[model samples]
Target: MIQMIKKLLVIFLALAITSCKTQKATESKDSSQPNVLVFYVDDLRAELGCYGSETAITPNIDKLASDGVMFNKAYTQQAICAPSRMSTLTGLRPETLGVYSIFTPLRKVHKDVVSMPQLFNENGYKTVSIGKVYHHSSDDKKEWSVYYGKEANTYNDPKNIAIIEQLKKEGKNPKGPAFDSADVSDEAYKDGRAAKYAIETLEKLKDDKFLMFVGLSKPHLPFNAPKKYWDLYDKSKFKIPSRKKPEGVYRLSLTKWGELKGYHGIPKEGDLDDDLTRDLIHGYHASVSYIDAQIGKVMQTLEDLDLRKNTMIVFMSDHGYKIGEYGAWCKHSNMEIDTRVPLIISRETNYKKRKAGKTSDALVENVDIFSTLVDVCDLKFAPVSDGKSLIPVIDNPQQKWDEAAYSVYARGKKIMGVTTTDGNWRYTEWRNSNTHEILGAELYEHKNSLLSYENVSGKGNYKSVEQRMKKLLEIKFPSNGEPFLQNDK
Candidate 1:
């Protein structure tokens, strides 16, 4: 009887071993379904070495551009963190969600929304989010299989931390200086910690089909980075952008850049001095470089683990940032500077080794990211998204694409500004939110320039262009029924 029991145990153990090996092989052999590595940077504008930036030191990002299809005309649906990110993740427009504030809960607004990450999670991909994938760590709890959050405080300097703490204690506004360059390690900051977490997660997910989103919080607010990155540039060589608003732009089109003003050193009203402007610009460049270095580390890991060939990598910013552009300190308007963003997509041997290291001038928006990913992964049964797939453009950058990219801005829930651009002309129309009555309009010709310094909307020569844009806006966002109108796909 004892011998029979031992023999039965041996057989059972062998079966369990075989089952475990079979499961592991199945998980790792899903080569048809490529793993996805997304580097989602915050407040990163199109100012990298690949984007013809003259001064920004972004070697890692530039290399990614070299290995991928770079989109020169990528724009965000909305120029804020939460709304823009939500639009990309859900393939839904901001008007569809009607969420503009960072504090608003996403699930409350769209209960049944299938986010991009959630879809991947449901599709057997190990979806992981590190750092600030969403505006808040708690924003989309159900979307990620694993989430690693960073500390709220972005400052490493003890002085700045003290100032913020004291202000909070006294029932006062708590914000540190606009920029801080501290002599410390990269891990001393939030972006660095995020990079470390990403590297560790990548190693764990190498044997599994996974979707990892690593968010870097830098080049955003309170430009805080290590001293080494700040030392890369000389502040004197940094060119300060125009400090004046567009000549014919309405007062409603611009904000006081209250976001910048909330910092300790920035003034509540009035123009900043040349020294301060240069310092702020310097800090921004440093933060960008810091992020680039971290990206290099993560990319190196992807290569070391032999996962680069099978991973579809995407590098993008949530939205653009305005550093002294048009005297603007932040992104809250429909200005071209605030709307255009940096986007790059790269994969090796995936989808039959399509074109690489190419640049696409085709107009694209944040919503299209979801559509493109779905198409690349061949997720046919996934819920239909609001965006048109950019695979046509990615496969062929010069192909005839969408007419124009659309973006919108809400002014205190009272006024709504809708804008569009067709690579040649940009137009904006402000309207009463509730009544949908057009209040004002501004147009800029971008044939020779991208600066919105002059509004030649009603100019005799551009009358036809202005009229065309108006019609397009109506087609894009109709005044009847649901405001969540989609692009004619």
Candidate 2:
């Protein structure tokens, strides 16, 4: 008995010693995991300096694109904000989310889904959402370790507040025009406050592996920007787009200008005049510059905390903005200008293949973000996705990819569906949910006109092209009006 006891005691001590060494090694590996920072912007399209914009003051954004892999053919799954955000976060399409508008929450419709940040949380990374990561905070409360959300009133000047109050007292709403260029400081805006929060969080999370989402709400509506950004542009340098209705396009494809009509100076029912149109364009450019500066601040903080080297950064907009394109004021259509967005992904020095300063024109979708992050971070999740991983394209930007991208826009069950970049063309079909009949159809040759200002689906010359595009859509989506990922296909 004494001999047996002595042998057991010796084995126990050896096992304990091995366990301590293993624990220490595991802790060291966990601490060295790369941080993730996603800078989500509102209503920013593919109009940055790196994307060949002549008037956009986006030096910092341009620099980010230059240092990262910029996706030239990135498209949002939906043009609407709430649905688009839900799709991107959950790695699901709008149809799968069952949400078509900002009024609906994803949690109500899809309870079993796991969001992008939530996946980081599960992986032992401290997840932090600084501002507007989701359309609503309640969309996914399980995701963030910390969240900072505030009302979007960036124009906090005392004088502007008084003017707004006076207007409210006079029974007049305070939505003064579709744009506001106040001669105030940048910090006076809500986005500036959000940036401050992001900077502070970066400092606190510098020592740990963290996933931070900083969303800036600008260039969305009211085009509100500090006067400094506005002064950067000369009105004479702006050119107003053609406001005429596109030839051969259905009226169903046009927005009724619901958002723009709520503002003060816009016409009740007509296209904006040249001068008003110029200011709106000018205001959008200023807002873009204004938000770009805020992004610069957050990025600088990342560098100050020395987190840049080990951080995997993703900068993207939720959806594309119309900004007077096609005489459209907002994103409520299936147009390429509305569905396409700007997406840039930057990996740290230690990442494989290091496609770090490259650009990929491969067709990609917003929902692919979830899977690509998982691929880069090596995350494993049980949930399936409609989005495919973009790791192949990241490893080789010249790799052949899916020939098309998909997007959905609906005004209550009346769906406008599309499969774009099919041989440099976009094909759209509008269907009535109650009746399985096709209500409308559109086809645009993007190579002929980068902006599909003219619709050619009705033309006899493009009849076969239309058929081919329609068949592509049918193969990807089911005819039963509900959307599900057919992975085997």
Candidate 3:
């Protein structure tokens, strides 16, 4: 009996040792996978030095583009923050998710949808979020393994802070100065703190597989940055754009610049004084340079830790922002300036195929980012996404791509405008939601004009182009007048 007991004990010990080895091997396999680092910026227009903006000083972003492939014609699914971000992270369109407002949380509508971060987390990668990845803090809490979300304020000046406090005491939302050039350290601003968080997180996760999202809130409203960044540009060099609305544009296509009007010094009505306009533009340029410096710090940390070679890095914005274009100060329309964004994707493995430092004019959308990352990382998810993988275009920028990029804007629940652009012509049709009857249509040519200054729908020469764009929109998104749900997937 004693001999038999000894033999069974030996067999049990052997099985335990084998189990330990298997677990170690699995961990090793996961850590061998490439890491993902996303630099998500807010309200950044494609007007950087990399995008041929001669006046903007953005050496960090320019360097990144030189090391990666820059998409010249990237468009967002929507031109607002919450919906645009939701669409990109979910790999679904705004209509599919039924999320058009920031108040609507992600899981509120699509409880079962697998977000991009969640996919990586479930696949054995540690996911981290620093700063403002989502529009709301409570959104997709389960998606991140670690979340450091300390938001910064709009103004750092003592007087502006006092004003904001008084407004809060009066039970009203506070509105501070339109722009602030505080003589403070870089860490005194939002993007600076976010960069520090990202760098620290990188140090902690150097030995493991991680999907790190570093969000930078800059070039947004209340343009505030360190005074050092403010000194990077000449105030006289910035030009205020045209204040006129496009001829024949639907009246509903524009807003009264209400977002900027609420600031402390802005007039409630009428055009901004030319001096104030130049100063606002200067503040914006300073904010961009400030964020660019923050990005540089994070990128330096990645290199110091030897994470760059094994990491897939993507630099993108939530959506484009309109700066004094057509008298619009914010993004809330289907115009090209609002929908177009900057996208740069870089991976060391891309160097094997000579894919680095190139420009792709292929029309791409923000939704395509989700699938592209998945494909590049060799990750797999069960559900098919709405976005097409841009790996093909990345491999060969000259390759033929989809006909156009699409965007939609809802003017309340009653009217919706759907637009399509192919870099040559942009076409839109506003329709009644229930009946899908066309209420208004717009067509703008991009062949010669920098800005779409007029609507030429049904014009003598552009009729065929308008019809083609309309058919493309109809085929891709049929007007069923129903909330598109994932169950329809």
- The local distance difference test score of each candidate is 0.84, 0.79, 0.83
Which candidate has the top score in TM-score? 3
Off by over 4 Å in 2: 1-31, 140-142, 156-163, 480-489
Q: Where does model 1 exceed 4 Å of error?
A: 1-31, 165-171, 479-489
Residue runs of model 3 more than 4 Å from their true location after superposition:
1-31, 166-172, 349-351, 448-450, 479-489
Give a tens-digit lDDT track for model 1, residues 194-281.
9999999988888888888888989888899999999999999988888878888967988889999998979788888899999999
Winner of 1 and 3 under lDDT? 1
Q: For residues 166-274, could you state the per-residue lDDT of candidate 3 as single tens digits?
A: 9889987677788888899988887888898899999999988888989888888889999998898889988888888889998788777787888877888888877
Clashes within 3 Å, all models in order: 0, 2, 0
The digit string of per-residue lDDT tens for model 2 on 404-485 reads 8888777565554544556378888777654446777888877643486678887888889888887778776645655432
**lDDT of model 3 at position 315:** 96
Candidate 3 clash pair list: none
User: Total backbone clashes of model 2?
Assistant: 2
Each candidate: RMSD to true structure? 7.6, 6.1, 5.7
Specify the highest-lDDT model's number: 1
lDDT of 2 at 194: 86
Lowest-lDDT window of 10 residues in candidate 2? Answer: 480-489
Candidate 1 residue 188 C-alpha distance from true site, Å: 0.6
Residue pairs with colliding backbones in model 1 are none
